[model samples]
Target: MSITVEKFVEEGRDPFSLEVVAGHEYLGRIIKEAALNRPGLALAGFFQHFAHLRVQVLGLAENAYLKSLTPDERGQRLHRLYQKKIPCVVLTRNRQPSSEILECAEAFKVPILKTPMITNRFINLATLLMENLTAPLVRYQGTMLEIMGIGVLMEGQAGIGKSETALALIERGHSLVSDDLTVLRKDSTGAIVGYADDMTRYHMEIRGLGIIHVPSLFGVASMRREMHLDLVVRLERFDPKKEYDRTGLNSETISILGADVPLLTIPVAAGRDIAHVVEVAALNQKLKQLGHDAAKELDEKLVRALERKRRM
Candidate 1:
């Protein structure tokens, strides 16, 4: 998804308090790339392998260099840079462009944005926003919650009590990331992050009850905007004859968007407290992360005891 210069100025927050100084009519220009480029070399007449598609940033050094150039030189350089179909150019540290640069931007229809933040800060924030706006997204029918700081995705057939269990977890102080449908995406570091569909965010539908606003009912702390997906829990109907894992000896994983996430299947029975069980599962996952696996430790202990008995 391409973000236009207009949207970037409007939706981008805080340090990116951008204002269109020129090329207002070209605000609709699409930023097809998710990277930013500093025009230091370009300003110095070096456009050999220029990334013109990215948003151009003019920092303190670039601004000073431009000031050092003769009026004719500056005009020619700005014109050449803008002729590359640049999406937009940002002036950082609230620096205003010279008349020649503004004229070139206007003539070439390149949007010029001014922000109060330093060059590095603006670049970092803008890069983050662009990455999120263009990140690859996948959708799944499930609920996402933060369990002991671990993102748990609950998946199961309809009417299998996914939402009910999520509700229970929320009541126990766990925050709900998303209900019904979850939008998952990978960040720059390759961690899968889950968010709710805008329409259904913070809302859940229970069996006997209608749609309920989670934040309103449980207060703001009960809801979360997004979370990194760390675990997946599938709730299955109990089958007496079905063979299930008797011990937590083997770890299972499920692939989501090309990432292998830890998976757990809990059979649902009439009197099973799935909510409490899931809470324990989340805590156990935390313990495993800390290098203590209860199942593995027990197995090792048993092996050591058997070796001692054999020696005796």
Candidate 2:
């Protein structure tokens, strides 16, 4: 998952207003480190233990130091830092690069970026963006919806009614996250976040109908851009020959991006209300989160009763 300086600049353009100030042709520079480096010590001629692989951020204080130094000394320091082979440099507060620094950037072929954001804020957001870019992601054919604050991924084969189930949930006041396809990513907090692709966000397709914009038909509140995944509902065709779990004693789970998510397989059948069942499942998941597991509690109670009878 190596991220290049060019990709970082393009992705951060909208949030950080990042733009290349120098080394345009050398944009292919790979960012070995996902973190930022404040080169205050490097600028002051300290080379020991320098993070040369990280992106160097030149903030106001570093600019001030450069202003205080003579031309020859400034060029010496910039050349020394560039000689260390840093991946790139970022000038914060929209600071103009010094001729000495620009010369070093060109000579070393190190990409230099500039942003109008404050030093600390830009560093924070840029670090976050880097994390997002490198986060573990998985895409699946499914419809995701937020029902009563619970994120649910409805997965099944084609014509299994995932989109239709999502539509029904929408009619019942639930918000649609994504339809037909959902992308899940693990965030820094170790939770899976499900979201729709940019082009298909807030849109759905029905069997006989064409594509429909979710918010336009159901109002703005009926659509959600993303949500923390809490449950996964797998819809399958109901067959009388197959046996299904009648007792909720054994809970099933599926791994998504290394995290075990609660899984429920609901058999699709005539007159079966899947949307209502999924909504209840979501509420049950919420209860489990609050430390109340009905199935486990009942199983425990039955075990205690049988033990007492055997003792008697």
Candidate 3:
């Protein structure tokens, strides 16, 4: 997916206050590439390998270089650089563009933006936002919640009580990221980050309860905007005939947006406290991350005891 320059300026948050200085009509230009480029070499009349498709950034050094040039020289260089039809240009540290550059921007119909953030800070923030905005995404029918700091995605068939389980977790001091439908995206580091849809964010549907706002009823502490999905818990109805894994040694995983997240299946019954079971599953996942696997340890101990008995 591509992000428009106009959307970037409008939706950009703290550390990236972008204001368009020129080319208002070109705000509709799409930023197809997530990576940014410093146009220092391009301004020096080098066009062999110019990354014209990426967002051009003018930092302290580039701005100072422009000021040192003669008016005619600066105008010529700016004109040549903008001729490449770059997506957009951003001036960092609230630096004012030279008249030649601004004129070139208007003449070439390229959008020029300015931000108060320093060079490196702005680049980092912009790149991050661009990457996230264009990242691969998948929507799952589940409820995402944070239990003991671990992101647990409760997934099952419709009307399987995903939202009710999340509500219970909230009552237990946990936080809800999304309910009903969770949008998962793979970040740059290959971790799956889950977020709520704009329309459904902080809203949960319960049987006979209708649509309810989670944060409004549970307070701000019970809701989160987004979270890195760490584990998936599948709630299945208890069945006497179905054989389930009795030991916790099952290394099950569910793939979402190309990231494999650990999965746990809990049998749900009339008296089963599924909320508490999911909470324990999340805590167990944390322990596994800390290099402790209780199931494996138990199996190893049993093997050792069997070997000793044979020796005796």
Candidate 4:
């Protein structure tokens, strides 16, 4: 997903009336402070760790190290730093930009944001700015399980063993995607793909087994970073009154990101091989894509038989 680019400003303030600067993000927000200005909250520490290319700290304050420079010397120093060509520079304490720095900023298209926030408070917000700016792209929640060479998304209501099914699949040679929640993204060509978040990449929770690492137990082939979401199999308790599609004649699909994906509503009964059914469904969908429809062929054969009997 593409983000709307806007000018950098001080955090906790309105975005309008701010000077235009060079910055790009899916969600634009202003940073309140810089590492030099805000020393307590460790905003600089956070920025140092996140390593996001999008954030730029502006106008640093005067420390003993920086105060050594005279006005002209400071201007030269600012120019040298600006030459690095970061996303933007934040000017703390609402200080005015030097003519040389301003000219260099304008020339390089680097935005200079001014804010009254002291350094410590500014760093706190800068961390937030980086955190919220990047929206989740092609990621999933929880743990994904791999089984039978298929990326099965074990989905069910809360506590219905979605993660457990995924864990089982992983033990049986499938891969994990996400556990409880999965973030879905659609590409430009209308393909929906899913991925595991960096934090929750290969972790899963089983009832008695506690937290087990899928990749460690199953090896590299048992894990996948992303999958195309070829099928959606929803598991539900068996309803006696409901008329399930025993013949597999109907074509049911699930819509995600403006595209229809093959869907299977498998009922969970005692001793039912849900994983096997899902694998077969995925294989069948592949066959259908190659123009082999078993149900259609059977229907055609039955129709021909009926016509022959009528003629006889």
Best by lDDT: 2
Q: Compared with the true structure, what per-residue lDDT tens digits does model 3 show for residues 155-176?
A: 9998778888888999999999
**Predictions in order: lDDT:** 0.90, 0.92, 0.88, 0.57
Minimal lDDT window, size 10, model 1: 7-16
Instruction: Give the per-residue lDDT of model 4 (tens digit) for 216-282.
Output: 8878777777766667778888889987887778978866656787767788887887666766776
Candidate 1 local lDDT, 231-298, one digit each (tens): 89999999999877777898899988788999999899999999999999899988988999999999
Residue runs of model 3 more than 4 Å from their true location after superposition: 13-15
Candidate 2 lDDT (Cα, 0 to 1) = 0.92
Error of 2 at 130 (Å): 1.1
Error of 1 at 246 (Å): 2.1
Report model 3's TM-score to 2 decimal places: 0.93
Q: How close is candidate 4 to the true structure, as a TM-score?
A: 0.58
- Model 2, position 15, has a per-residue lDDT of 99
RMSD for each model, in Å, please? 2.1, 1.6, 1.8, 13.1
Candidate 4: what lDDT? 0.57
Worst 10 residues of 3 by lDDT: 8-17
Lowest lDDT 10-residue stretch of candidate 4: 35-44
Clash-forming residue pairs, model 1: none
